[model samples]
Target: MSDTQPPRVDAEASTTADSANAPRPPRLGGLPLVGSTLSIARDPFGFLETARETGDVVAYDAYGTESALVFDPEVVESVLVSRADAFRKGEFETDFGELIAPSGVAFTEGERWRRQRQLLQSSFTPARIRSYAEVMVDEAATLVDGWDDGETISLREELSRYSLRVLARSLFDLPLEDDRTATVIRAANAVNRYASPRRLAIGGLLPSWFPDRVEREYEDAMADLETLVADLVAQRRAADATGDDLLSLLARAEYPDGSRLAPEAVRDQLITFLFAGHETTATTLTVACWLLGGDDAVRAELERELAAVCGDRDPTVGKLGDLAYTEAVVREALRLYPPATGVYREPTSDVVLGGYRVPAGTTLQLSVYGIQRDERWWNEPATFRPERWLASGTGTEDGGWTLEDDSDRPEYAYFPFGGGPRHCLGMRFAMTELQLALATIVRRVEFDPVADALEPSLGVTIDPGPAAVRVRPRREK
Candidate 1:
């Protein structure tokens, strides 16, 4: 279970390993070395379809390593939550640990991850996130102010800018005054494109001695990100201030041993927050806008809720709870296109999942994408229905919403922000950011899709495809 020990099976050995001795799972039959990689590369949904055809528990080879693609929610739960200690973040994440930065929650494991999580948990508490709402609302207003009525724009691009501004102000205590915001936005997109699965799979196959282009791109992006974070940290350190900002909290944070985080640790966490916090929230907001535009009923419902709660004033943390339909739209969007897409784990010991005995060291992929839409749990799996979330009486009785019942749903089926002790540290911050951005956008403008059909494309996060929307300012009544 030690982090330093490599898995027993080498990448090449996994390619030729016999399933007869090892537990055999259903598998797609096509090519020898590259099984379903083309289908997965072309369309991730299609790859899931192939996985379904094979069965809930299907086997596949990626980068010369055999992996089990577990689509069953219960089985996914076993790996992610119920028996989480039996699993570790798979080799794919480990290979890019340095690329993710050196010391934040994502790159660390075991005691290090636990210690960091403990120290950072207070920063993302619901109350703390609520305090950050004004920052989000202010930034959102700025974003909407720049848009003209009846003008066509990419929702994805706009939300990216908006979320980056929110993250910059809330997390780093830095205003999105000029080129800094643009640089962060560019770096995030560059990192996303470079970390696409197609590139990662190819890079995973290459030897450690080789320089991966994608890796280099990721490093360059991280370097820019580090410079921004380091400058911020140094400034805060010189001022000796403990301001009500995430960076200040981090800068002043002390370990149980009374030691401050090293500069590299600060840089790593800043990068983690930037990548994990903004990008996913931005994507969710963009998809929410697209869904609202495409469906008249949903848009009307959202507008009604927003008008009722917000009235003529901008949304504050107190007002956010009143936007029920807005929250519903966000929930449905996440269910349909979870930003994390999938949770990955590797078994520490032989374990039986979905009636198959997977050996120790087997890499496992828990498909949040597949399980969220699985017919077994949802009535109309493919439809955009926020009512389903309401039926369980878990979200909110009044206009105000809470996540009480979200956990009551089948475990891994609802991981927009992952699960277990290793769940995203900034979940509350991201949610607050999304809620404010979404409510402000709805209040200022009506949106309509420019494309006939909008599709979710798989990237580092699930992204909307080839879709621009026309935005119009709401008429004064």
Candidate 2:
């Protein structure tokens, strides 16, 4: 499963006796029984930032679960990379049976995850993504075409819909009609809400077999989504479909021993891509726009680059290589509010992290949010400076963006996309789309934030909430 999958939180986990004598990480105090639930939910970004200062690896009790939150790059690397085999993704993997699709890559482990990753990896290659770029530009342009100058719009909501449509056209090779869009939205909304930390806290306390209200809602939404995906697959097969989109690629793929993905397997992957593919990019884009909207100098530089490189035309694939500044803006936005706030991993056996023992059943959360913002890895950590991504050696020379220079930095310090084998499959696709869409929209509209500061809605993704903006088309030269 992609790291973008809502972390499957295990509130019931406890460390073993083997780790009893290990140096304890500082704990953030919280209310009785409920622990730090309310505080974390109220301001996750703020909480993590403050918590990281307590120590790189700090313990926190949220919703009755004792978790060690890792913020240091070396420690984050240990969990996500070096000792990866010693840990498995927590509750979401062993639990959440049919709650999510039945056994997709995001939740699978060991050899199962390997097989699925290998099979799916072929469809997202650089060449395949290049072939898919036109669909991205067209979908983005279509969304921009619908906006009005000087009109206030929720960039989050609009881009959420746009990214969903882009996923359909670019990878799925389908354009969502109104009804289809509604179904997907319903499924996505329910899944995100039901999987939220608040919901997980409550749901984890109850017996697994108990039919809860949110579980019923999730099942209903999944039912609609599964039916839609199944029908699409069946329709393709009945017509002897021939195409190069991801759906068709998966439809025609085989197992090493001359077997095809099970009917349910196809459904699982389709649901994963459709549900996960759009939300992260949309969140990143909304946050990026808001950041740029509030900064004239950054926006002007971005505008200047767009004008110089794209020049009176929509951005084509070849021109994107010159859009270094625009790409940096997206990267900086991601650093501030990564699509996945934290990743959850549980050690199967006792492991040493930051000189502390994480015994079996103890859950470890790598706080991507805290690490990205922590000054240990950044210069002026809290600043929204896209120039952090630029260096002297690489430049367009015509005053466009210089190449990003972070050769001195550690990779784990700013991994908006989680690292190691389970890194996001859609990383390149999402990056390409973000740059094109941002360029397409900013080439015309300039955003002015409606409020002094936007607040984050830490749902399935850390969305920029309901922040609206007034967009006016830039005057023609």
Candidate 3:
């Protein structure tokens, strides 16, 4: 099974041990009150690098909380998988989840999160994701048809629209207009800014009710999101027959006692899916295209596979299994630039990690970006080589490549969608979307990077800043 596949989170064994004499992790020193907030705000990658120098488990005060930046893959697995019940979503996640999607599955803990996940799992089953394939390709084709040959465009901008369109039609069964897409883009940016280190640092000094400009914009954006969610819920409810879309499935979903989700609860799910469903996929595609643009051999290999499997026709659900190279490109891109950046958790009780005793309520930062690119787990870790995802084999019966058996790698070493039971609910849906959309677009056009370098900055997601590309029709069949 793919390591990304959900493992039994109910394993009786816990990784934590009672080591009362275990020393506290080495600390990453910073300012008295705000701690490393400014350092992180200025350069998150640099801050993470500094943490690496300190040790595998480096403790520091973040916004006055006892926090540690963990680099060891084993410790990461302990926190995310083996000893998952021993931790909860940290204060950062709880605060941001409330700002973005209160009462949604992303923030709720214990029984509430479990119940919500069970109710929603039906919509993301393998069969259900397969049902979304047609919509994914149709949106990709529409996006390609609109692009003029040799036109320079922002990949993030164009792909974000395509992703949102696919998300709307497939999940909500709603068609998007230019205006609605624009609204979502703006609102997503506003919400993302709230999690920035600078914002959080300043927020600590200000009272919650303070009427600051950033605060005002955030509230307005949230209001707009709430309005959008309300409208979608209303539309789905008024329909004559319930549809197979996520919103429709959620509308009729019931708990063990037969109680349906309240209106606000349903709204929260819509908003949560809206943000998670579209944004992460767009970031993945944007980076994939950017990486593909700079590499000739990889692009040629991708095109060869595309020709072998898809011919002149656009990608479809039936062809995805044969598009191994295309899937690898997406995987490699995610490995380089995971959308979540890192996972945050807090010890529910004092626990031992990396032979250190962590106090209860101490925040743990598991850097997905750091682990995926570590030299120990990945050879030539920084290179964009999709071939790494292929196993040592010749051509398939249909002349396609075979994907790698990643069981050799550590489980926590490559978790762009995260791991354990809290693994992204949309993991399958997002992969299917990226593969179908990528193959469809590549079959139609080729991209050249308009800018030589990608200035990656920290945000709610890794913003692929200034990723402009020139698009033209592919010359070869």
Candidate 4:
């Protein structure tokens, strides 16, 4: 295969509609109009699994809306990278625009997105990330200190607090009070709980003006979130202080024309980071710890790497390269349960996908969850196996610490951090934080989870459902 040739996988889609002008992908769902929206919104992961069984590319009626779900890697490439110019952030993201605003980088596109990305790029560079590692390590160690040996802890809540604290410290340069941090965590979880796809779909069936408790709760959380940041920004402005945190970075940031982000825009960006960076990384850490808790061999191997690389000291960027197996374990956990369930984008103009001609403006849902779990792409797709990443040997040269490139695996198959130009900008920092936290925590404590099936509790990000771990110190301090 030529390097430029977009590598094709054994993925195919069933056509839903046949037309000389636009051939549709296969359809998956129930009766017309409402379609599969209810089923999908009720259990998103299960819905996607069923959709994939129907075809690699399948069309479904989501409430009054219609969308094509892309499970094939080639189609994902076309949508995210190849034909990226022809597509921009679409309906699904726009649905949450009120939460982050169009000015926020996550929801913006075109020139605005470019400028926003450029303005924010410096905050996530190698040097910038290295600077943030100390905050991450300190937060991880602090979390460790709180855990007593043989104490049963709720992984999700504790990790949520830890991740929020890290973001609060590293990005904002302010410490979150215990009460305030608890409020933040509670509000975030409330938003996720009520913002399910089913709720949105059901709500859509009603008038636009109809009251939505979950939506209201999510808004309340967002309001609390905005107030929290606004207060911090106000304090920073009053104090005339700008430290090394991302808040400091943005407050002091200037465009080429020497203009600064407006106050509201600054708040939007802060909330974006809080939403995008905090909960997702928290989910990653929580799930990683849970996954390791179940597998003794994996934990032993990771502990060995931690002892060899970090010894009794906290982990930092300088020691990341030595935490190969630890990082691989993170990647594998993400593959098994990606935080972001699906990716959505729309075509700017007409494009053909999966041998079916698709008209412009058709909303497409690229199932990241389904793609990563497809048996065709992974061996024992359902099992938690971190070693597959090591065997790939694609990124071990960096000691498996860097994000694994698409050299060994299909590019779109495992895009937990996303791909193309719009891929996550915080990838490096998130990876760093996860590796450091995993190393720091595992080095000091081992987790023994209570026996349970542990179904994924779906929310803004997937969480390990209701599983508590017994934290036991592995070695003397």
TM-score, structure 3 vs. true: 0.93
The digit string of per-residue lDDT tens for model 4 on 1-477 reads: 112222232222212232244545667757666788788777777777777877777777775676888888878887788767778887767766664554688987778778888888867889878888988888888888988888898888888889988888776778989977876776667666666676767777878787777777877876786777777777777766656567776666556578777766677787788778888888788889998888887887777666666666777789877677887899988888788877888876656676665566777878888889888888899898777766453433223333344465677888888789999999998999999888888877888887565668654467666568899888532
Q: For each candidate, what is the lDDT?
A: 0.73, 0.78, 0.82, 0.75
Model 3, 179-298: lDDT tens per residue? 888878878878777767778777778887787887788889888878877776667677842676677766665564787777667778878888988889999999998888899888
Collision pairs in model 2? 1-105, 1-106
Candidate 2 lDDT at 442 equals 86
Q: Worst lDDT window (10 residues) for model 4?
A: 1-10
Candidate 1 vs candidate 2, TM-score winner: 2
TM-score of 1: 0.87
The C-alpha stretches of model 3 lying farther than 4 A from their native spots are 1-17, 205-211, 252-257, 393-399
Misplaced by over 4 Å in model 4 are 1-22, 206-212, 242-244, 392-408, 475-477
Best by TM-score: 3
Q: What does the lDDT read for residue 3 in candidate 3? A: 22
lDDT of 2 by residue, 1-477 (tens): 112222222212323453564655667788888787777766666677667767766777765667778877877787788767778887644454356665777877788778888888877899988888888888878887788877899888889888999888878788888688778878877887787766876675689888798878888988898888888887776766567677876666566466777777778888888877888898899999999999998888888888788878988778888999989999999998898888778888766566565656667878888788877679898899988898855445355667665877878998888888788899999999999889988886788898888888664367678679988877554
Q: Could you report the Cα RMSD, in angstroms, for every candidate shown?
A: 6.4, 5.8, 4.7, 4.8
Q: How far is candidate 2 from the true structure (C-alpha RMSD, Å)?
A: 5.8
Give the least accurate 10-residue stretch of model 2, judged by summed lDDT.
1-10
